[model samples]
Target: MAAAAPALTRSRRPRLGALERRNLRWGLLFISPWLFGFLALSVFPILYTFFLSFTRYSGIRPPVIIGLTNYERIATDPLFWKSAYNTLFYTALAVPIGVLMAMILAVAMNQKLREVGIYRAILYLPSILPVFAISLIFIYLLNPAYGMVNALLGLAGLPSPNWLGDPTYARISLVLIAQLGAGQWALVFLAGLRGIPIELYESAEIDGAGAWTKFRRITLPLMTPVILYDIIIGLSLGLQVFTSAFILTGGGGGRGGGAGPDNALLTYVYYLYKQAFQFGQMGYAAALSVVLFVVSLVLAGAVFRWARGWVFYEAEDA
Candidate 1:
């Protein structure tokens, strides 16, 4: 029996080796593109940026060692504070509004209604629109004079503020514009909603649970992981808001740059860009990038930690 076992093992070794070699070849071939791209584009740039953060380098000149000077300067910079405040404020306002809008739309879409496919297409259309196009459209729409938004407000006898021009309304306008792109969030949430087992709903109904009760007890709890995912995405994107702010507020760079009326739309990325490109403070901008990276990491980590108590997983329950 022992002699036969050794013979069987020896016979299987060659077959296993051949199979493993074949799988290894295919796996390496499949992943070569991703590996190449990551090393060239992501890894090299990240390490280079870290090195640059400690040195002062303009595009025209070689980098000079300037240990912590940029960080010290940013420590006292009021513009940095203002931009941070604006970013956090935008995140605070936009995340909740976007998530709520997405959840509502997702719930509505989950209904067994006729022409559901058409409704989904119409609802998801905004998400597929080019961001530049959306920004341009909003700029035209928010034109206080002869704009569709103001024209509608006039018909409704409501006050129409200069959305992109006024300091108070500029930030609000950006938030509202962001909500127009909530179709992506809705789609994500809708997928999550569909993944919930119908049997759970049936069991809840059998227990005499009403719509609100089922949502609170079953739906909300089950959807916590999806909610966490959306919140992280929204917060990360919100903190790095640049394109819409830049295009909408006239893309410019200088000490006194295009930050809208009263610098209301002066986001962190915009400020960083101005520092790096306009003022020749590449080191400072790198420092700002580090700070933004750290803040995002910290916030995401906190969310993950907090989610432990609330984010339900069927595998964990099992």
Candidate 2:
């Protein structure tokens, strides 16, 4: 009886006709371009870099096997430690601030303010500005002596800090530059805020929930999923932060010398860049990138695990 049932089950797994099978094959063939690109550009480079990490491979020379040397160098290097520290600080400061600002702006903009579309466009325009252009503009705005920042400060008789020129102010300058993109993040959060049913807020209002109570009990809880998404994105973007620092600090190799005046802006990716291109340490750069990936993975995993308790879902009752 068991053998007969097994035979019956085998026949019930409906097979595709020749035309269907042919179509499937053709579909795979059509997607071969994507598959090839993934393999070549993404997969292969990652694997090759992983292997390269254990060797001493300058850009022009063949990789010479040197087990653990690169990792050891990374561990012992003072500059590496400084860059990592600065990167973490930037991440800590920027992510939360950006998240909060985006949420606030989104909520305000959602309030049916006059010509709201115009406001949205104006706010979003900063996010789309070219990095170079923004950097150039910021260059003048933050000019230590003649810049608007200092000029405003000087009006109040406060000491002016060299933004790009001083170590203490350089990392903060980078963080400020990063917040320019917060509008884009704000837009994403705005969409999420809009996704929340107006009925929920109305119900809270009818129930005698004050504005703060409504926000605490209803809005924050419902917004968690979106917050988690933005948090991950901000974290990743924070880690991969390179271009702004690169353009601002003069590309880690130029007359600027170290990142800004005192290595304040040498984030992880920037360091990897300096290693690969500036020092021609391709293999080592690859290893550093892998370490960066692992760190991001751990951080993201932590956020995901923590999000579950805090994140609310409308389907909980369902």
For model 1, what is the alpha-carbon lDDT of residue 190? 93
Give the worst 10-residue stretch by lDDT in candidate 1: 1-10
Candidate 2 local Cα displacement, residue 298, angstroms? 1.4
For model 1, what is the alpha-carbon lDDT of residue 49?
A: 79
Clashes of 2: 0
lDDT by residue (tens digit), candidate 2, 1-318:
223222333566767768768988999999999999999998998888889999999978789989988999888888788788888989999999999999998888878789889878888999999877888788888998779989999999999998988876888988898888888877888888788889999988899999889888877888888888899999988888888788887674443225777788788888888888878888788789889878999999999998888887677643
Alpha-carbon RMSD to native, per candidate = 4.8, 4.6
lDDT of prediction 1: 0.86
Question: What Cα-based lDDT does every candidate model obtain?
Answer: 0.86, 0.84
Model 2 residue 106 distance off true place after TM-score fit, in angstroms? 0.6
List the candidates' TM-scores in order: 0.89, 0.89
Please give the range of 10 consecutive residues that has the lowest summed lDDT in model 2.
1-10
